[model samples]
Target chain A: MNSVLDIAFTSNIKRVWHPVFRQFGLLALVLPGASLFLIPWLWMLSTAGKDTALIWKTPPVWIPPVYHWDNFIKAWLQGDFAVYYLNTFYISGMNVIGILISSVLAAYAFARIRFPGRDILFIVVLSTMMLPRQVTLIPLYMIFSELGWINTFKPLIVPLFFGDAFSIFLLRQFFLTISRELDDAALIDGCRRLGVLFRILLPLTKPALAVVAIFNFTWAWNEFFTPLIYLDSPKLFPITLGLHRFIGRAQIDIQFLMAMTIVSTLIPIGIFFLTQRYFIQGIVITGIKG
Target chain B: MAARSSLADFVKRRFTQRTEDILTAYLCLLPWIIGFLAFTLGPLVFSLVLSFFQADLFTRNIFVGFGNYIDLVQDPLFLKSLRITAVYAFVSVPLGAATALAVALLLNQKVVGLGVWRTVYYLPSVISGVAVAVLWMQIFNPRMGLINNALKVVGIEGPSWIFDSTWALPSLIIMSLWAVGANMLLYLAGLQGIPTHLYEAAKIDGANVGRRFWHVTIPMLSPTIFFNVVISLIAAFQFFTQSFIMTNGGPNNSTLSMVLFLYRKAFQQTRFGYASAVAWVLFAIIICFTLLFIRSSSLWVYYAGEERDE
Candidate 1:
């Protein structure tokens, strides 16, 4: 590989003098790739900053005349984003706690405990990954309605308490990677199973826990379908559903809508950045090794 | 002393040991077992039963014995939804997978600011789906949209993307390709796993960059590609959000996906039985496709650890 690197370096140096070929090749790959992802976001930012008349102008101004920072405040007030933020935070927080507890306990069982039919049960759990949520939606809705849990946060929070297959799988993979010697030592020390989980496993698996937290938070935050179907009142609406209301109420106000969109999107990205060290480590460790 | 023990004592000890093991294991599994029974198995069986009956919002279900499936086979809307879903799946999965692989290959080059570039590409995938859809709706607006204005600058007229029946599904496909970051990350992992010695040997044999890529890089990355393809296909078949948010299956039902149609039938029209049937059919189709892919994977998926048969 080092030799290949040397040869590739020489070849690249020789090829660089051919400016036209180099530029074309580089531009062909990089330009389209970057523009495909970036241009729309740039357009969103620019449009959000523009005034109403300028937004509709021909040859659509790539830059706004003056940065309308008020669009953010206006969108915040008009969209009732403060309420949406609180609602989203509350639901997502509850969901995160629910998923973490359920997933960790389930993962510990699958990873550490031995019992008859364990493998069969694990397979049953994994098989649910293939079953699309659409298949379960109608019947689940009926069950919820019968229980009179509709139009409440119960439908949203209760499912997470039962455990999610993906989160369980991820945490199990992390657990399996840990050394069994530690568990044996804990056992010799007369630690009960639950004590081992809390005192030993939980402390060592912070990366996995962080991954679960971030994943649950993001999924709960961005979830649209269930929240859209379950929650009827605007006061209970998450940011995702709240943004939809903005479009529904003022479809023509592109500037205001884009501003609200940006505002709503910022928190998740911020969360990702803050927890990213553990997130990437979690993925590379659990996903690849498993 | 143990051998001299009475049969009652031995039997009692064995029974206690058995009970202790079972109790400990079951205690560990208690939460997941309860969850599986409640959320997964219960709903699964309920959906299966519901598919066979006719029900409305205000009344109990009437068992009709496959009547919903029969109605579905004869229904034009169901057929249209299936066709639309098939096209959406076939087009988007391959396109998204190919784009992700290509971007991954390009970024795999020893380039400066690679981390920054990776983050920029991944930003859209992390953005709220509603926010992305709403933003793209503005970008794809018929007259005053950014896309049209950009096209007009180059003397080309852009179509009314979401409003035009001809362009609506394609417009969603275009929007979906923006979030190729997840697959890109997967591919990057795959790329990193390729052994460096092979590339070294290829260089010693005077293989050029393109040749090395085709012969070495591609063969090594096939498994990751396969994984991405199957997963992406499954996801695309259930496509709902873009159509739900942007087109709402409008302009003559150009984008009435299977999932979207199911949602409308169940929620909007309150036809729970027929919607449940549609959901089952979609699930069956997804399973069939996945099985087919799994069957075919042995032909192309190169397992690094497997020994070749002589």
Candidate 2:
């Protein structure tokens, strides 16, 4: 991996300036452009620490004269982010568990089980990934409404229990790569198909499981459209909904809004930074296989 | 008679075992099957049926026989939203693909802190959804935003983004550039997969950097590029949250997207039938574009497994 990633014509660098100079030359090309990408985040952090008057400054105060430490607290209280945070955590947590159980089960079957029509069934599952969610949105909304699940967390969390097309695809691809000898070895010990999955395959696929957990959680955390449509009441709203609703008042309440935005994004960003490898690996596996 | 009876019993036992294996497989697939039937297939079939009826919150659903779709043809708002969505998809797909490839190429350069640069560039996708929309709203604020403030630094007046009808769509396009990180990562992986020996061979031919990129890098990465185009196109057509949260399809409805239009029709106006029809239209457009993209791939997309130009 380290070797193939080096594509630059580096022989020229040895003939030119010092080795350190070459590093600086590459950084000079990359750093300026990268800083621009980081600006919105940095700019938001700056505003979160400033007064409303300073936020509107033409030259823009890169650093606030007064570090508003209380802005986070103020935003936390005013936005009622405690309940929103709890709601988001509950929804995302249940969503991840649901996705894991269903996807792992289905992926194991698809990868290992050699039943009649298995290939056709697997293709059907894969094809669902391409179906536009919008096509089904109206009917799903109406169905939940009829079941009296609207304005509640049921609509948001229940669908995940059935599994997602992408997660199933991801896990299935990972499962296919594992040697089938492990499953056969387990089965010879008087284990059933389910036992083989639990005792051998599931334990072996931890990295893939981690990948699913990360993707499902991040997706649930950042989800907006579904919650936007279903969860009408503020009490049940996730942070995304809360932040969106608060934007109307963002003009008048600039300080707290910036602080709230910063707090809301912290978890997914943290997860991303922490688990960068599994996340990128998941993408590569999916991209190549799919 | 005894020999025939033994043969029949043996066949019966084998059939039962096979049935059991098949049953176990299905039991494993039960969640997906049930979910598909209840959640996916049911809704799709229901939506199709609903599109032919006069369904709403106020009145009982009345079968109207393609009335909603016919109404779609004449409805000016539908046409307007369709046009806006079409334009957004056309511009953003290519721009997003090009920028993503560029970022991939830049990051592909062998350097120290490569991981750090990759992470920083991907930062925007991490903090996305409504947070991203709200963040950009402030950044594009005409009088006080960072973009205009920077423009003011150079003594050129900045356009009123997201508020002006002319610039609202374009502003959304600019903001869309921020989330190209995931696609970039895929391209980065594609870059890695291309054996370095290809580059050594290119250099042996005395290919310059520009020629190497055009002849080697682009062709090698064409499969990834093709994937990006299709994925970006499907996503771009479903442009909702940015316009929905930031502009609400406002400033003379210049930024009114198809999904947002469908949402309003169903929820706000209680025109479920109309909304269902609009969604079918969106789905059809996506299918057409996807097919077109696949058809065009043979002309440009180069599979590494196939014969290469000698």
Candidate 3:
């Protein structure tokens, strides 16, 4: 009595019809849906590799007539991308280190230690996570200006050492899942507080740490608003601001711009792929725990 | 040997014990506390004062006693920017969430090449801001862009896109879909979290695919939906950079987002007090929506293994 489309779910018909009918049925549903997500990236890649004039050709060339390697070189040197990449990577590295140390320590305390006012403090941190960054943007800028930290990496890097609320929450959640018996055993084995944290808990929390690292790295690398607000010097520009400047002040060579876009995208894409499982797992855990 | 060791251990433990546990805990929490004070709470408190005072980087503040708020009401462009932003957020969040959830449901099935599809879907979201915006700008270019070229193939004329006042916001909304992968992934996580036993029970009760989705999946996924809704709404309100970069708040200020307007006001024109008032107004609006959503969530958001009072 089931229609062909509903046959996949009907128990009696599914076993008989699944081979071609159901599989192809799924393909019909999945391919078009998948293409909506996939085509834009493909177009970007294609456009990046194509000739500048050929891009606007009326018939729309899906395949490039010839690959232009010079676009990448021009965008790299002419666009001042070397300075941007260096500044962004350097900021990202400092951020990773700062977030790791602070978030791990804070998470460990919240998860394991007994202290008065701990619950209230944790609540405060969680609430801060929901607040949009704009709420704090103005005052933070003024404070940095007062401290003579504007136009320097101080505004960018100094805050990382103070722990991000989300990172702390994430690490704390991960730490709670760890067996406490390991802590007691480490304690009885002539280990002290820092020792347990460094050797046992930290190593066990690698996935969580990687998630924190990935988030900080991407955030610092791509952060434009903060850099725009705080840094006045062109030399202090992160890649995001540098690229924005490129779009505004420089050439409109679509070919070169696409190449530059690809280059800028590579680091995050590389990071995502390298930590693929961890990214998925980390996000999943966070979503479920929420 | 055991007796001797036990006595020595007892003495060591007693010596190591201190009533400084509170101090030790605080040491761990020191960085966050400092950060909270300096970056978050400090800025928040200052924003209120800055809103009432005509303050910027150069000039010392002159308190204007709600003059900024008064100007905000009279300012035509401010109201226009708010309307534009509200429209953008209201339209995009629900549409984006629905598309993301739909794609997630499709991807959740036992489809072949799942990894390829997932990576492809998530690829654009990870690509960062300027790059994606630049790419989309190219895609939305007036005549020679990919979208127009495709439209040509279908014998339909494409609008000037970001350049055209009528189509600019829609163009941005369409571009916003390119990164629905982030939302899709969250929904996927929510979907996978649903227990298989529930599905089995539904199947035994003769529930069809549509019925299972409506009855079992929806209620279970309500919490995730609520969370995404609130988060996306906040993000939508804070939208900038794209409008700032792509159209410079546009041909007729059609795409002049509130944040873009705030950025221009505060940084470009150096009207810090007015900008601070704008930011607080934005914050207030966001708080209103968030509270509204949170209150309404209780009517439908279902947490498993828990019962709520009517």
Candidate 4:
């Protein structure tokens, strides 16, 4: 038995250490995926730190001699990204709160309550998820125009107060997984339905709520279409729309643009890195069921 | 005391209980109901109505009753946009899904610093679409872009990727592949869900790694593959941000997508009714394609813990 165990272990090592296997083992797998995914960002970072001359040089410098940390400062200042950041944060923050409040209420009802036409109404809400926002763009614009809401943040933020189908759907799925006995107990404790939702379910569903918040934050921050359509003032533009002004028709400053691009992406990437565990779990469950 | 109460009193109490139940349900549903009516349902119905008319910026909609749809069918540019969208969807969806699956398969392997690699791969997924477009525009710059320089080192010259008509769509497709992290994460979940016993059984049967992957892994992962395909197809059809930012559908509308064209018509040209018609047509196309995919999925999508009909 000892010899057999020894042989098995040695053979495993030999198999792993085989020249062909070892040559292609980890490096081969990591390289192609990494290059495909990482090289562009590295290029963006490297170029953003280079001067114009170095940027335009033949054979291009993959790495700059000195990192121009000030380029980020310059990009931030000159691009008026300070204002963009403020506007973006304000809008995204409001939108997240709005989504959470309205979606939680709606999702709780869908998950816990029995009502006439409940299934049909839920299906109607879910069906809206299938309709691309583009399909409704023109009509929505017309409505906003009639209301004189264009060029204002109203168009961007107001609709968010109305529960989004995707958000509600996700939150409802989370709510459904929770036991009903908790709600019954809350009712016996003199808690109203709304009170139960706030005190009992919301606390238990922190991960789901976090997922919703993170999703909303990133999406709202990166949202370009609505901002571009509704916002006419450059001061009101988000980082996404503001960044486009740098890439004009005739010529583009490659380094400056890359620098600005890298800077703009940092916030969302940072948020994702911070909350990735919840985000991944959310995606897995949602995508599989959806 | 209950025996002494009149029948009318008990009936009145029951009526009140029913009304309370109804009121409670409506109260809970108020936000979604109002939103659905004002935002979603309202706009949808309005679009359906407006698609039958022609409206300028200031005038009342002139009823044309399918005129815009007819024009869409006849317009060469609309046809071109539709074809472009179809091609974009077909190419990008498959490419994105394949890359995602490949990366997920790699990440599923027992490796060091797995978390770091996962984060690295996911970084692009979180980056703003406009930022990615701008970044890639520079990277694909014909002269000094890293891609071109790399090609020059190999004694080959890279084409102007964004500017060249032939390369613009493909450039966007390549850019889409950069954000495969979301799908990769989905695939990872799918991979982990596959029972390990299957692989072990295959190994004991003297099946090579390739055979095990084909017979065991691929079949188990088909549902995820199907899901990715459908979602990616839907997204690719509405491809707008990259083209709008990078190319502005430029160089003779080479990169003009269905959504971008709709945007141009509605926002730029101020033909709201016409754009509505175009949008409806797009919706129909998407529905048809989605239904087709869903119908076809039964042939391939395998659900665990379900009996196969055949």
Pairing residues by index, what is the TM-score of model 4? 0.93
lDDT of 1: 0.84
Task: Give the range of the ten consecutive residues with the poorest summed lDDT in model 2 chain A.
Answer: A1-10
- Expressed as tens digits, the lDDT of each residue in B125-202 for candidate 3 is 787777788889998987778888888889999899999999998888888888888888999889988999999999
Q: Tell me the TM-score of model 3.
A: 0.93
DockQ of 1: 0.51
So what's the TM-score on candidate 1? Answer: 0.91
Q: Tell me the tens digit of each residue's lDDT in model 4 across B116-145.
A: 888888888887889888888877889888
Instruction: Give the whole-model CA lDDT for all candidates, comma-separated.
Output: 0.84, 0.88, 0.86, 0.85
Better candidate by lDDT, 2 or 3: 2
Tens digits of per-residue lDDT for model 4 on A76-128? 77788888889999999999999998888888888887778888888998888
DockQ numbers for every candidate?
0.51, 0.53, 0.57, 0.60
If ranked by lDDT, best first, what sequence of candidates would result? 2, 3, 4, 1
Off by over 4 Å in 4: A1-24, A249-252, B1-22, B204-207, B306-310
Clashes of each: 0, 0, 0, 0
Instruction: Count clashing pairs, candidate 2.
Output: 0
TM-score of each: 0.91, 0.93, 0.93, 0.93
Given candidate 4, what's the lDDT at residue A143?
A: 82
Residue lDDT tens for model 2, B204-274? 99999999999999998898888878878888899999999989999899999999999999989889998
Model 1: runs farther than 4 Å from truth? Answer: A1-28, A250-252, A283-290, B1-22, B205-207, B306-310
